[model samples]
Target: MVSLTSPAEAERRPYGPRHRWVVLAVGVGAQGSFAAMFSGIPVTGITMRADYHLSTGALGLVLSCLGLGVAASDIVWGLLTDRYGDRRVLLTGLTATGALLALMAAAVTPGDGAGVVLLAICLAIAGALGGSVNGASGRAIMTWFAEGERGLAMSIRQTAIPAGGAVGVALLPWLAQASGFRAVYAVPAALCLAAAAATWRWLHEPAPAATATASATASATASTTATASAGATAGAKEAAPDATAGASPDIRQKSPLRRWDVWRLALAGGLLTVPQFAVLSFTAIFLHDVKGEGAALASVTVLIAQIGGGAARIWTGRRTDRGGDRRTYLRGIGALAGIVMAAAAVLTDAPTPLTVAALALGGLLANSWHGVAYTEIAAMSGPARAGTALGLLGTALFAVGFLTPLLIPVVIAHASWTAVWAIAAAACLLAIPLAPAAIRAR
Candidate 1:
């Protein structure tokens, strides 16, 4: 996989291997916030219901607001990172989000309209800023790693989302059980603040060095032009393409929409997301409503899924490193997910252990494509515009995710619980063709 990297990309990519782990750590930290922010939906539903006297629909509205925030802010954060840099945006966003999460914790209480509205606003901010993680972290990994190794690295980074979410699910409930729902928000707040500090201390904008070098090179070229013009050589009067001007054009032309590869990545990302978000958003509901499970049991089941998804993420990354085709793996995972989801739909009457285990395995296979898909995008786009490409991919996937709650309820309303699972299975099936197209584009 010889990467057709621009000189700017080549210069920006870390030559030494030491920076890879640092980039991975940054990715993990950024992604961990995503899990924390979104985890509120499952644990805080009862609290919100009690506090705000929210109906089921009202609770759904509150949760959906977070998705709306992410959808609205993803592109903005992406552009900011591309233009200014990731370090400042990431650090500031994380810190602000952490404070807001804590504030939201205090504000969301019984009979508190102002509090609820404030909480919603804060959640929106968190979602929007947290959305930047994909772009910033993906860009870092892509810029720091070589093509052959990027798939594995990017996969590992992608795992942080599920892994972080799983931790949140496990921790928040136990905390809420012992203390209150406030603990759920409080824990993430602390973690987010810590991540913000860590990012500030350790993160560096790798491209600044490249920019400086380009600037110096431009200055030297200008000096040469001045000298040539002073000599008044008619042969040298032709305006050659200045290296600095060429570099500036490269930056301007880095839009992901202009690239065929980016569109394929986004489409494949959307296909993969349809199922993953469905499970993430609704697993607790399925356990509670269909399987006659309690909140505790449902939360536990969701936690199991998260664990499977997280472990599978790291494993998938390692497997990709060992020469697995990402497209093949994604389609295979999707197919397996569809089969398992179908079984889950039809076998809803199965024993508790069997049903739970089936869903856990389903989660594992369904979410395993996280690393591979992003890795492919990073590889396909090369390093220079990795952030832009990943930003577009995240936008498409998150946009699909925004529909999960709405779409799934429609299935559950018209049909039996089995029909809901069947719908998810169908969604996974839709990903089959896209997987090969995704790999071919890479």
Candidate 2:
């Protein structure tokens, strides 16, 4: 019931409530641009293999390089975001990523005599740069939004992955078929540049006094109330530390890198991503090669799944914002995703319509949990360390992302597509136990 915003500080504030929405928009653009590159590129996998004369494993390796780069650089970027702030990190990373993509378009072509190794190197570098987007954008959302609406805000930002992927899957394969892979790279390059320009034009930090007062009030309210609102409870738990150290300083003062709860959340998120990445990286291959579906249909299925996933994320975010328990919701999602993926694995040889339905459902369920998990992570670590916490989680997710593609081919070679889906289902089920339990109201 205590008010954090003083009348004087409210009068001094430059941005209005609408400005946070603008910041969210900019974050979506920055994140979606990179998502288009990583998630969308795989839609061109079949064409890429044929054009480059690549083996399936080789194609997997090339795709995995992007994940490798992102995983390697995410923590470092998080550290930099904490130190240097979001605007600088987003602008530098987006511009550099766009330029790298442009270079790839110009030089790393089938006709230009470039090999897979060169292509892999370019993708890795682009991924490393693009890795800056996640932590920086996420930290911005945590800073700008109050605890009550943070779930919805973070979920909206997280939807950019599927939204960008939808764009990529819809456009890239067609471009690859009509204009060649050069055009494929060129499109995302332009997007990155555009996103960079937008970031520069908008995306400023909130007033420090507003943030400080909110923290102090939330911390005080948390200590006094036996049963507070979800927003206040979360705020109290994650609020910034006071200047004077008490017998036990707030957990916010501890580095996210060293925290067990942060690690659990990161590991749970990484495990959950297995099925999502499986769908993202190989559903086209599964549908076309295994089910005898047309390439166009396969691409359309992926596009639909992405759009559906994006919608699910938004709904879940809003639902959680209305006082639903985030950790419980996350576990429920994991269970449903596992069930869906397991069904897909079991029905691998069913009729085409049924098979497609299973795969689509699996993708939808797998993609739905990201926003909730990310919101929980940021809330646990507090806004001050959000970048580092998010970066650690990104590293885990991308490391799995990198490994998923590379391992899928090996699984397919020895076993079958059923085995791959089954493993993915298992990973999803495993994640439920690892999701960090909700913090009790102290």
Candidate 3:
């Protein structure tokens, strides 16, 4: 009979170079999926006006519904990933979301209200499916990488969201220009399906330890590292140690809700999202309606925000990894951006170019905190509970997400776009003072 070995030996077995690519692909695919999920924002008003003849308020509800779905699924998917391995959950999700997007393309015809409802349902489905990508990818990276490099690696993975959004905003509009929204969904859908298939075929779990069968000739002392190395699979019988034993000294088990740091980060994250989402939800419309810019120009402006946001995430992530008070840095950025957003709100009627520039700068600074927040979450939760921590954080953020888009239209109807941005700025500012307390707790 064959003997089983320790888990410690198993982790030492390194993958081939090709396997590294598989890991990277999973990270990128996860980020890109989220990017595609949010692509609906820019085109929402245009679609509503063109098809179903809905008012801005109605379209806002639909947009908010999408966020509701994402928020609703965050906890479910996070727990699922923790129970099941990240690979299976992530692959299944990508496939299901892609199918829903394709279904959306087929269901919604131009100017069809029934189609609009169906499309909203499809969007909700896709958002739920997309929820798994972030937590799963974060956990996967934690599992695969050593402690030293996790920050840079995770930041790169996180970069996919903004990069994918940039791609969607930049490319989807052009695709719609040539064809239509129906055709537009095809691109992201196809990408998701292809990535899903690739993940399933290529991904492998951490290998099991080598086994050592007892033989009459074998001696315990003789079974040294060199001896085990010479004999094929001789070390399989050794049981693995806990992966976390040597990583950090401060490993503690705490309830997610009990952790003040988690709540602070989540709240701060949610507040920061207000201004970002406001701009994302309304930038295109503001450009089209207020600035009298064409669809192409509006698309460009959205793309700029996405690209800038994406790059900022990576840069801040690396910076946090290097050494700084992540909470302080994040809070400072949030506060500063809030001030800028408040200024932008007041200057909304300024020259078109100046207004766009202000929005872009505000978006960049506001979103720059993502990598820092994500990195801190992973650190705070430790590797084992990373999924849960990320899930909880996402749930809180998306809960706030559910309100921002719809709130924008209501604010715009009664007040002005300036009022909406001002309120969002205030929301960001609310988090500034709380951040210091959070850092102390951490």
Candidate 4:
């Protein structure tokens, strides 16, 4: 089983005190590089539709392909991370993704139905490869950072999504406009390659002593807790073993596939993504078709949302690290996201700027909870099973990611954009109930 090392142990390693930071940077790079593809690809929705001669529904299918691929592969990658380690999985996945994107850039072109089909197939494959980033990078953070610091560390890692999205929205639309989709594909390929290099050079396992120390710490904590429960009433005593099960090294070492807390958080996380993906997948098109705004304004709005979301994630992480209930924060964030999305739905016919601001705010709030949710998942499952827990969460998230886009167009056809946002708001609200009530952080 994989074990988490404290920062102090990391500092004493031969690689230098700052080596963990290097690992964090590489994690950020790996995640951001893939984010550039999955999150950024939607930024080019307008261009893709025009170039590929696709209807709105067809465009959504293309977008959903990436999510579908990710959903399919995340669990596999997560299991692999537990077995093979972070560096190897990340290197293999990132390198292959880069090469695939390079080939896609050269071969994919505007032409017939075949072109759209081919592009979708390639994107699905890219998403599968890129899915490696989440579990591996997250596990690396869990391994290197202690409990007190992991919220912040993981939040910093989570920022890569919006940060990469910011870069993609800022650059890819213009690239698609100025050059073509070829350039857009090439850019992410380069990012993947660069991140792969960094991972190869820097990411490595913690010292064996650190792993042993962490295991001992976990066992000691469990023993203390079990001892404390010894004097409880009969009913409490009966529940003691189950309550302390998560703290046991034996339980910690087991796969997190069946953990109710893990599934609860995973499902909640998936539901929360509805609002986020709504903004991400359709904002540009909405601005263009409904608000009569150009791609530039749409891109700028998305860029602002991404930047704000990233900053919000960092702040939320730090705040939770200091003192706060992560589950409480998560539910609160979800509630606010639902409220904001509902307001956005109501304001769809309002003044253009007001509508834009509402959507942007909804996007920001929807995105801000990721770090907290992920931190809760890892903490509940323990560091040894962080990969499996994270992977399970990823599968849920990307499965929702897959479905949201494809369904959005159908909602638009039958109902309206307001209905779409309303449903998204409902999804956020629904997720609030699913968050685990309390978790004993590892």
The 0-to-1 C-alpha lDDT of every candidate, in the order given, reads 0.65, 0.83, 0.68, 0.83
Residues 28-104, candidate 1, lDDT per residue (tens digit)?
88788667658645555654556566655455556666776777777677667676566666776777778877876
User: Which residue pairs come into collision in candidate 4?
Assistant: none
**Which scores greater on TM-score, model 2 or model 3?**
2
- lDDT minimum window of 10 residues, candidate 1: 237-246
Report the C-alpha lDDT of model 3 over 1-442, residue by residue, as the tens digit. Answer: 0112233543565654335446867778766866765764455456555555667777777777667777889877777777776777778778887887787677664633354466667667777887777787777766665333455567778778777877777777667656776777778888788777766655445442211111111223333422445321222121111122123434436645567767778877888888777777678778888888877666666667778877877777655444344666778888888998998898899998888887877876766777677766766776677778778777877777778987888889899989987998898899887663432211
Indicate the residue-level lDDT of 61 in model 1.
55
Give RMSD (Å) of candidate 1 vs. truth. 11.4
| The best candidate in terms of TM-score | 2
TM-score of 3: 0.84
Query: TM-scores, in order shown?
Result: 0.80, 0.90, 0.84, 0.88
- The regions of model 2 sitting more than 4 angstroms off are 1-13, 209-248, 440-442
Measured with C-alpha atoms, the lDDT of residue 351 in candidate 2 is: 88
**Model 1 lDDT at residue 200:** 64
Q: Candidate 1 at 353: error in angstroms? A: 2.7
